[model samples]
Target chain A: MVGVRVDGTTRLMGIIGDPISQARTPQAINPIFAGKGADIVCVPLHVPADDLATVWAGLKAMPNLIGFGVTLPHKQIVPQLCDSLDPLAARIGAVNVVRREPDGRFRGYQFDGQGFVRGLIAQGVVLQGRDALMIGAGGAAVAIAFALQQAGIARLVVANRTFDKAEALARAVNEATGTSFATAGAPTPESGQLVVNATSLGLNDSDPLPLDVSMLQAGMTVAEVIAKPEITALLRAAEQRGAAIHSGIHMITGQVSLIADHMIAALG
Target chain B: MVGVRVDGTTRLMGIIGDPISQARTPQAINPIFAGKGADIVCVPLHVPADDLATVWAGLKAMPNLIGFGVTLPHKQIVPQLCDSLDPLAARIGAVNVVRREPDGRFRGYQFDGQGFVRGLIAQGVVLQGRDALMIGAGGAAVAIAFALQQAGIARLVVANRTFDKAEALARAVNEATGTSFATAGAPTPESGQLVVNATSLGLNDSDPLPLDVSMLQAGMTVAEVIAKPEITALLRAAEQRGAAIHSGIHMITGQVSLIADHMIAALG
Candidate 1:
């Protein structure tokens, strides 16, 4: 490339996705990025699922390329290719983070759970000695639920439209950590301590919310993992009812740092 | 990857090379990158010759990928893939550029000759009515000679260890552009106009410079394409004898802006 001035001294990182522009990797990491004295900057790269292998290989061979964030389709695929996979990543059955170490090895880690825990802690949302209702058993749901347990949230109910996935996730977490979990339907603030929505139902203006929050108790806290519409239908509804709401911005912000740290840790 | 701040508005460009970093795409671009009001960043990617077809097809499919710079093996391949090629690009036997049109189509062009020409012009070194001697008949040699002719250089003697390639470059430029080209075996100040070392000589510290300037002419200018040393031995020797000397830096600077313009034009 003519005017593009890359060299061995230039650091490289990227987010690989079919549609790369929608990602928030830039803004969320900006604060810590400025503080870290990092000579690197991450950029977005579009790699369709079908061409993922070839593009991934092409990226790895780049003399200036250090590592990349595996997005969407590549996330699941990366775990199998990595030199090592963090236990939590293997347990969650997905990899939303990947990096190339200084020794030139690619490592995969999942930071969704860790980011959720850190974000919650930052907001002073107490998890210890509390009961949590995790709505939706998909990627983010399982991650949040597992991280809550790690943070000492003693009681958790994993719920989903398809109860099997929720039950499976609960079983996987419970078996892995010996922390007993219960399966429940959509939660009520009366008994559920921390009310979280991991479903895609409230993403758009037209979609219905996961559950009616009018009945939610006044003290019940709410969180949604839908980052695009920072305040999802459920979050907005909870806000109207005067409940504490944690927008997905926290989780998104927490991920880049957590992942960067993991990548650095992996290198050592 | 860290501190990368790509958002929906980021203007995108890419550098295409197998071992990409050796070429300085990012450094050259960053210096002139500010004040554009656009998030213009060029990312480096390695695409090998064998996988270029499919990988390039995938790259074209990216909606945000505005333009790309080609290097090494890809320099010649763009002509075959492009719908049309700039006549100069075809004559030079390679393309170092592929720009996106506003209509989303890409066109191919070559800038090596123009870069060398601009390098000469920028230094205020006159070429009009000057005779020249260029060593090596490779791509860079041909490009520099063509540029020398375009700058109104009157006579040229191309000397290469294997003179056939030099002869071919000379014949092609002459037939294609109607430029006068002449060849000679030995370097003599009486016949020297400008002496350039275009071969892959003078790379390492121990490597002998291809051209000896013991009989250097004061009126002649000396130049070379090898960038690593910044001061090639031939250029140093020529400078000591009062001949004007230009390094690869000016050539690189001259070429970078054209590549950026091509990329922006490609984006349409």
Candidate 2:
């Protein structure tokens, strides 16, 4: 079987999350490491919420540790642990990746939003002049909102179960992008050319779709952030409505190459 | 091209040492993990002396981390960090391995000495009725002395640059084994049927032999603990004298299987 060859000198990177067993970065990224002939292996570290700070401190002090991928409860909290943050990650108040600089400083970056945008672009969806309706204002949603704005989306509507959070996310995205392109409102498929499900709503089989499928129109593109069920209810509904659909797996697979690049550059 | 396959769920084991790039445990033990179908990988961790406590504490907190191998400067210090130690390791005041228990407690064990005895036995050398003359009273020497006593060696003579340390090691061995089987003395090939160079004397090409080569006899067995050169100057001299000789590689190769067994058992 083609796989990573770990030895004494192999560089180490890890993904930190409470429930780390299901993390897919190892399989996704290790093959890339093997293909590139990079002597690095990414492992999953189960760091509980309470032990996050301690574990993060420990990992940073390791001389051979190159970087880390942050997820779930860690993404939002890890930005505080970094020595510096990418402007996007700083504005979003979350970090999905931490790379150790050549001078040993740990710098954080958020890849979720960028990954989502890349996935959409890879699927031939044009974001430059399109409007987007984003559901959920949580960590993933915040990242996707900023990334969409950065990708030159003409306008964005942030909708959430809590209107205040959506408003706050919209404000943050607009302030960071220096544009009045984002507004908080209820999701309407007819109002935007792109629809995104950025919440945990589609994780369960019986969970309701994040947005109304009846509003979906042909030529519109829909995407979901939940990867376990690649075709979430929201995506399935959009697909049935004759809209171009992008599954959650694309978001993860899209980031693998970019993350690998960041990690290799950081190794220097 | 055969190597360990690492994934997110692979249990992590590390070897802690200052200069860890040359450590061979990753190559030796990882193959064992793969062969046994154990989802485990041993990696080399370059943990400096100052960062040992912080790094070790962090590693222990990782829920999936099973155990570690302590080498060089960390060996003696690591035993103090363990919740409990194997009886032999406790007596020798050093630990070479630490295994996490099912209840999450970390216990340490010293495999160096045991590995040496096993290597000799594997080579068909009889230890039960043999007398040994060991050079050096450092960490490796102390372990070998204790293991030789435990292996039913008839007697032991420890020689070192500093006589007090050798005396102390001999005393510890006798006290721990409840027998007057070991003594501190000058290096003499005539004193014991088996002569061991446990010191770092043969590490350089220009260094003198640990003992007088002319003193070696045809029926004697000579062993060295240095593995890098495989056949050290002492072993070469022993070979020239037509005495039975054991290389330092035996010490490492013999321990690989035993260490693999301990690590797998600790996964429980």
* DockQ values per model: 0.27, 0.60
Tens digit of per-residue lDDT, candidate 1, span B151-197: 78888788888867767777877776765566545545554477777
Q: Please write out the lDDT profile of model 2 over residues B1-268, one tens digit for every residue.
A: 3567766677889888878888888888787778899998888887888888888788888888888888877987888889998898888888889989888999999899989988888998878888889999998898899889888889899999999999998888888778999999989877348999999999999998889899897889999899979888888888998899998888887787788888888666
Q: Which stretches of candidate 2 lie over 4 Å from their true place?
A: A161-164, B161-165, B190-192, B215-218
Ten-residue stretch with the least lDDT total in model 2 chain B: B1-10
DockQ of 1: 0.27
Give the Cα error of residue B147 in candidate 1, in Å: 2.3
Instruction: Looking only at chain A, give the TM-score of model 2 against the true structure.
Output: 0.93
What lDDT does candidate 1 reach at residue A106? 70
**Chain B TM-scores of the candidates:** 0.89, 0.94
Best by lDDT: 2
